[model samples]
Target: MQLLYACVNVCVFLGGLAEEVDEKVLHAAFIPFGDITDIQIPLDYETEKHRGFAFIEFELAEVND
Candidate 1:
Protein backbone atom coordinates (compact mmCIF):
# COMPACT_ATOMS: atom_id res chain seq x y z
CA MET A 1 0.00 0.00 0.00
CA GLN A 2 1.11 3.52 -0.72
CA LEU A 3 1.13 6.00 2.12
CA LEU A 4 -0.07 9.42 1.12
CA TYR A 5 1.39 12.71 2.33
CA ALA A 6 0.74 16.40 1.76
CA CYS A 7 3.52 18.53 0.28
CA VAL A 8 3.62 22.18 1.11
CA ASN A 9 5.91 25.20 0.67
CA VAL A 10 5.79 25.47 -3.10
CA CYS A 11 7.35 28.65 -4.41
CA VAL A 12 5.50 30.35 -7.24
CA PHE A 13 6.65 33.35 -9.20
CA LEU A 14 4.22 36.17 -9.70
CA GLY A 15 3.99 36.88 -13.43
CA GLY A 16 4.41 40.67 -13.80
CA LEU A 17 1.66 41.19 -11.24
CA ALA A 18 0.56 39.34 -8.17
CA GLU A 19 -2.91 38.87 -9.58
CA GLU A 20 -1.56 36.97 -12.58
CA VAL A 21 -0.93 33.83 -10.58
CA ASP A 22 -3.70 31.27 -10.79
CA GLU A 23 -4.54 27.68 -9.97
CA LYS A 24 -3.90 26.42 -13.47
CA VAL A 25 -0.28 27.53 -13.36
CA LEU A 26 0.25 25.91 -10.03
CA HIS A 27 -1.23 22.62 -11.16
CA ALA A 28 0.93 22.59 -14.27
CA ALA A 29 4.09 23.23 -12.28
CA PHE A 30 3.44 20.31 -10.00
CA ILE A 31 2.31 17.94 -12.77
CA PRO A 32 5.74 16.35 -12.93
CA PHE A 33 5.32 14.94 -9.44
CA GLY A 34 3.65 11.72 -10.52
CA ASP A 35 2.61 10.88 -6.96
CA ILE A 36 0.63 14.04 -6.55
CA THR A 37 -3.02 13.27 -6.12
CA ASP A 38 -4.43 16.76 -5.70
CA ILE A 39 -3.42 20.40 -5.37
CA GLN A 40 -4.99 23.47 -3.80
CA ILE A 41 -3.88 27.03 -4.32
CA PRO A 42 -5.60 29.65 -2.27
CA LEU A 43 -6.01 33.24 -3.40
CA ASP A 44 -6.69 36.45 -1.58
CA TYR A 45 -10.37 37.30 -1.87
CA GLU A 46 -9.76 40.99 -2.52
CA THR A 47 -6.45 40.94 -4.40
CA GLU A 48 -7.22 37.69 -6.26
CA LYS A 49 -3.50 36.99 -6.19
CA HIS A 50 -1.89 33.73 -5.33
CA ARG A 51 -0.89 33.45 -1.71
CA GLY A 52 2.61 32.78 -3.11
CA PHE A 53 2.40 29.11 -2.25
CA ALA A 54 0.20 26.03 -2.51
CA PHE A 55 -0.63 22.72 -0.89
CA ILE A 56 0.06 19.51 -2.82
CA GLU A 57 -1.26 16.16 -1.75
CA PHE A 58 0.86 13.22 -2.76
CA GLU A 59 -0.54 9.75 -3.19
CA LEU A 60 2.61 8.12 -1.88
CA ALA A 61 4.89 9.00 0.96
CA GLU A 62 8.00 7.46 -0.55
CA VAL A 63 7.91 9.43 -3.76
CA ASN A 64 11.14 11.20 -3.01
CA ASP A 65 12.88 8.01 -2.04
Candidate 2:
Protein backbone atom coordinates (compact mmCIF):
# COMPACT_ATOMS: atom_id res chain seq x y z
CA MET A 1 0.00 0.00 0.00
CA GLN A 2 2.89 2.34 0.73
CA LEU A 3 4.31 1.75 -2.72
CA LEU A 4 0.95 2.58 -4.28
CA TYR A 5 0.74 5.72 -2.16
CA ALA A 6 4.21 6.78 -3.19
CA CYS A 7 3.47 6.25 -6.85
CA VAL A 8 0.46 8.50 -6.63
CA ASN A 9 0.91 12.23 -5.98
CA VAL A 10 -1.71 12.55 -3.23
CA CYS A 11 -3.91 9.99 -1.49
CA VAL A 12 -6.22 9.43 1.46
CA PHE A 13 -7.68 6.54 3.39
CA LEU A 14 -11.36 6.81 4.21
CA GLY A 15 -12.72 4.37 6.74
CA GLY A 16 -15.71 3.65 9.01
CA LEU A 17 -17.94 3.49 5.99
CA ALA A 18 -21.12 1.45 5.68
CA GLU A 19 -20.96 -1.82 3.76
CA GLU A 20 -23.28 -0.41 1.12
CA VAL A 21 -20.84 2.28 0.01
CA ASP A 22 -19.35 1.95 -3.46
CA GLU A 23 -16.73 3.70 -5.62
CA LYS A 24 -19.06 6.30 -7.13
CA VAL A 25 -20.37 7.36 -3.72
CA LEU A 26 -16.85 7.65 -2.39
CA HIS A 27 -15.85 9.78 -5.39
CA ALA A 28 -18.81 12.13 -4.89
CA ALA A 29 -18.00 12.51 -1.21
CA PHE A 30 -14.39 13.50 -1.88
CA ILE A 31 -14.84 15.94 -4.75
CA PRO A 32 -14.86 18.95 -2.43
CA PHE A 33 -11.34 18.04 -1.33
CA GLY A 34 -9.83 18.20 -4.84
CA ASP A 35 -9.57 16.59 -8.24
CA ILE A 36 -9.89 12.84 -7.82
CA THR A 37 -7.43 10.88 -9.91
CA ASP A 38 -8.67 7.48 -8.77
CA ILE A 39 -11.09 5.78 -6.41
CA GLN A 40 -10.64 2.19 -5.27
CA ILE A 41 -13.12 0.16 -3.23
CA PRO A 42 -11.70 -3.28 -2.80
CA LEU A 43 -14.21 -6.09 -3.20
CA ASP A 44 -14.35 -9.60 -1.83
CA TYR A 45 -13.85 -11.94 -4.76
CA GLU A 46 -15.66 -14.82 -3.06
CA THR A 47 -18.62 -12.85 -1.64
CA GLU A 48 -18.84 -10.02 -4.22
CA LYS A 49 -19.20 -7.48 -1.44
CA HIS A 50 -17.48 -4.14 -0.83
CA ARG A 51 -14.92 -4.20 2.00
CA GLY A 52 -16.47 -1.09 3.63
CA PHE A 53 -13.61 1.37 3.02
CA ALA A 54 -11.93 3.23 0.19
CA PHE A 55 -8.74 4.78 -1.14
CA ILE A 56 -8.92 8.11 -2.97
CA GLU A 57 -6.18 9.50 -5.17
CA PHE A 58 -5.89 13.18 -6.00
CA GLU A 59 -4.55 15.08 -8.99
CA LEU A 60 -1.82 16.77 -6.99
CA ALA A 61 0.29 15.97 -3.94
CA GLU A 62 -1.07 18.94 -2.01
CA VAL A 63 -4.73 18.04 -2.33
CA ASN A 64 -5.02 17.02 1.32
CA ASP A 65 -3.39 17.99 4.59
Q: Which candidate gets the maximum lDDT versus the true structure?
A: 2
TM-scores of all candidate predictions against the true structure: 0.46, 0.75
**lDDT per residue as tens, model 1, 1-65:** 87233455342333342455566776676667655566666667798666665566656545573
Candidate 2 lDDT, 1-65, residue by residue in tens:
34433325577887778987888888787899989888877777888987776788888855465
- Any idea what lDDT model 1 has? 0.56
* Model 1 TM-score relative to the real fold: 0.46
The regions of model 2 sitting more than 4 angstroms off are 1-7, 61-65
Model 1, stretches more than 4 Å misplaced? 1-21, 61-65
Clashing pairs in 1: none
What global local distance difference test value does model 2 have? Answer: 0.77
